[model samples]
Target: MELLIKWLSIALSSSVKFFAGPLLGKVYNLPWWQTAICSFLGMMVAVILFSTVARAFFHKYMKGLFNRNERRITPNKRRMVRIWNKFGISGIAFLTPILLTPIGGSIVAISFGTHPMKIIGYMAVSAAFWAIVASIGIYFIPFNFH
Candidate 1:
């Protein structure tokens, strides 16, 4: 029961913030492989939920809230567009685990009209890769903060 709780905590935190997975895993002393899988699953859950269900919900209920013609182009949006133009979905996926929350990344992808499957695929790959990388880093590397 305690073990399940720890894993669930890691997964829940990872869903909101990818970096928290590794940190929580380290705190809980879980195996690196388990940490990696949990982290990947957590982020993927958010990505899938937002990319599919949330997108549908937005289109149905909040479509009128985002009138493209009336929307102002903020600097943040400009930067996102620049990145999208330069690297497309791959770039977004690459940055998602490191920079953006899973929900945030999914919303960005959906806003740019990325297909749901494509969002899932790219996010899955990114989450798996980063989960492994972060788990290894947190588990194996000893950081002595003074």
Candidate 2:
């Protein structure tokens, strides 16, 4: 079904870029609720699975590899750390979906040692909120594709 494929596309999109899912929804002319829910669901699932698995893998193997870079922080990483320090987990989660893809956000959260459940909760809420914003913005843009 087209809807199923569309939903899957939106879900997968969250892993790559912010606003991708919502943009897909607008392009597909999906209802606002469906757009929001699908986007949230996609981000939630991606974050939960990615964070948990990544955490486990990191703890088991990647920890030592990352320790090599502990002495030198990239500028981007320094900025991210500053943001993390200023806003903490909640703020990061709420803003991640807009600032970064679900996967990128999860990676950042994991790097900062945030709990996976909290990341999922915050990202889900963010995804839903952003989806609503995107839908509304697109709807009111005066550009009718119909």
Candidate 3:
């Protein structure tokens, strides 16, 4: 029905931005708030789905996909590990949204042994923050000048 289509459109549009904000912004003609809300919601969905996938299917079915190639943990890795260790789930959750893709962030949180609940909580907050900032930036900046 019409209502279902509309809801589906909103969900799809928002979810796409959740994964790829810049690309979705160009394609959807959505204002920043729309994008933000949709993207945040989408990211939350993605995080939850990803957490489930990572635990139930991805680890076994997509082992190669998630496999680490680098042998050296590197200074950045060390720093991340240290932060995660120090702050526990909070650190991973807070950083995941900003530092990684919805999928990547979820994977990293899992790899770091962050709890699923904490991962979702952190990602939700981080996604909301970025969405707000992105929306504000898009709204205030003038574009398409005559």
RMSD of each: 1.8, 2.0, 4.5
**Consecutive 10-residue window with the lowest summed lDDT within model 3:** 14-23
lDDT of each: 0.91, 0.78, 0.66
Query: Which sequence of candidate numbers ranks them by TM-score, best first?
Result: 1, 2, 3
Model 3: how large is the Cα RMSD against the reference? 4.5
Q: For residues 6-80, what per-residue lDDT tens digits would candidate 3 score against the true structure? A: 434544544444435533553456666666676677777878888876666666776665476956668877877
Comparing candidate 2 with candidate 3, which one achieves the higher TM-score? Answer: 2
Q: Report the C-alpha lDDT of model 2 over 1-146, residue by residue, as the tens digit.
A: 98899988877775577577777887888886777777777788878887899888877887787778558779977878888989987777877876777778888898788888888777777777877787677656777656
List residue ranges in candidate 1 displaced over 4 A: 144-146
With candidate 2 superimposed using the best TM-score fit, by how many Å does residue 97's alpha carbon deviate from the native? 1.6
lDDT of 3: 0.66
What is candidate 1's lDDT per residue for 104-131, written digit by digit as tens? Answer: 9999998888999999999999999999
TM per candidate: 0.92, 0.87, 0.67
Question: Least lDDT summed over 10 consecutive residues: which range in candidate 2?
Answer: 137-146
Best by TM-score: 1
List the pairs of residues colliding in candidate 3.
none
